[model samples]
Target: MANLCVAGGTGQVGRDVVRLALDAGHTVSVLSRHAPQAGSEKHHDGATYFAGDVTTGAGLEAAVAGADVVIDCLEGQFGKARKRFADGGVRLLEAADRAGVRKAVVLSIINCDRSTAAYYASKSAKERVYQESPLETVAVRATQFHSLPVAVFQAGAGVGLIPVFKGARFQPISPLDAAAAVLEAALEPGSSEDHRIRTVGGPEVLGMREMAVMWKSVTGARGRVVELPLPGAMGRYLRAGLNLAPGHAWGRETFVSWLEKRRETL
Candidate 1:
């Protein structure tokens, strides 16, 4: 096990990284705006929560001080997601380098091939940081989360209408699955200097409409089903090459299967 420092340890995907790293017997430092609440501390004995913000560079030197690897998942919302994703990571990289850390991995979105999509663009920019960096870097891009469809359907529940992308396809994975990959990559040395990317996707791909109906039925969300054709030919290709890697790694939970397990809980 390695000494691992995780930024954004409180975010959705970051939570999984903290949990998995701790469970794997690695010493963990989870950086958050504040310490974990009392209840949140019980599951991971290996995890130490450090109060820090990627933007401020607070508490980061200590967090990365003795770390063998740093996993960055910090992100922002809207166009802000892009800015913070780029700058926040550069800050962490500086801290890690100063601390003499060896391995670094960052979570990025797919097809962030440049500033194409606001979110993807930001991710792409951050990827560039690692490219120019001397530190060992790996950018593990994951598919849209398996939880997303459920989220979309749930948010639309109050409106009593579900919007479906008729021809759009999604190859989503559980956040845990994605997190596992980032962890694995952090430990495994690779060939590329920055190792620009990799993808972790579900066992199968499904149409967006079918996914919505399955979610609606399972969650018992009564809403009008408004099917919208794929957002344009481009929508079909939104993350066209992302969320997939035929032989890389497959998410244990399929889209509908994860929904089945989450339905009662949501």
Candidate 2:
């Protein structure tokens, strides 16, 4: 089995990648800003954790040393996307190269290069960094996660109103499915000459209104689904379905099914 290191291992997608890597019997190491305390919710039994900061290159050499593959699942806050993704990706790739990593995999958003949104632009920049790296890099671009709408709806539910973009549609994939794709890419046999990009999306695409309604039905959330005009480049991007990949509908879980499963957990 390969020695795999996952950056941002405590995040949503990172958690699943770490779990799947361990289940496959690979030696797993997690590089994060803070190591999980023993018996904490973020701690995984089979994986080792390292305190590392990708942007500043702190603790990175130790974290990546002796690792065969590095899966970059790092994400940045709203105003810090460039620092965390573009600059941080460069640092991470440099460290991985120095440590003789064979392969690198990164999670990205579908159609990120076509959008002017700050976050999407930063993601596209990160992809470029990975593509140019000497390591065999695989970029997995996925559609929105199933949890996004829930977060939006939940925030609005507190005020009894859920806003649905007037003309937007979404094809949201489960983080579990996305993580599976990332792990598969990280473990795939390849050389430094090989660099690939792939896309994955949910099983179905639905209007924002339709998804909002379904969310309310499943959660019994008391809120009026208000249709609002989503302005700006991000809105236009969503309305044009630039965020979708119907041909790459690789995920098996439907939005409703995910909601049902999540409800059971809660």
Candidate 3:
């Protein structure tokens, strides 16, 4: 276990990464706008909190100083959120570069084909920070987190909201799986030297609507599942081929299991 700096460590995925690292007896420092809430910090045995803004250089250098690795699990902002996220990512990467940190892990998305959506464009750019850097790095692209589907889009006419294009498919994995993958990548540390690896979705191919139904059934939520329209040709292409990996996907979580686990929290 190495000393680690986790950016966006308060997020769903980031929090898990911190937990896994600490469970393994690794020391952790989390970068957030403010220190993570006391409850979150107290759970990790070897945790330190760093208050810094990734969007700017403020306090960033100090936060990452002497850390073994830096993991970025940031979600871009809402209005042109991608640009803001991309810029902030660059700042963090530059700081990492200047500080001479050897390894970094950045979480990217699966449907990040820029032509397909504006969000993808930003995601693609933020990913560049790892691929282009001279530092040894790991870039893991994952499909949407399994349990967060409700937050992705809303279903107006139904209990479950299934956003679809020309039959888009997804292999949503759990936040825990994604977090574990990122940690593994950091330890082994992939580089552009190796083929870019995408930690895509899992064993089954399910439409967004099907996912909604599964979640509803597991949670016994009253939500009705509805299929919504896709916006354009780009959305159609993405819907048709975006989130799936042909085979050999390293996914370890399924929607059903993800829901069952969430039951405890609910």
* Best prediction by TM-score: 2
| TM-score list, all predictions | 0.89, 0.95, 0.86
Q: Give the per-residue Cα lDDT of candidate 1 at 249.
A: 49
lDDT of 2: 0.90
TM-score: which is higher, 1 or 2? 2
By lDDT, the candidates rank as 2, 1, 3
lDDT of each: 0.76, 0.90, 0.73
Local accuracy of candidate 1 as per-residue lDDT tens digits, 99-217: 99987898876566633556666777888898777888888887778876677667777889887755557788888888888888888864556555766676677777888888877
Q: Looking at model 1, which ten-residue stretch has the lowest summed lDDT?
A: 230-239
lDDT of 2 at 55: 74
Instruction: Note the residue pairs that clash in candidate 2.
Output: none
Q: Lowest lDDT 10-mer window, candidate 2?
A: 77-86
Which is superior by TM-score, 1 or 3? 1
For all predictions, the C-alpha RMSD in Å is 2.5, 1.6, 2.9
How would you encode candidate 3's per-residue C-alpha lDDT over 24-127 as one tens digit per residue?
Answer: 88888888787756665434556787888876778899878888888998777478556688788878878887887778888887757535466777777777
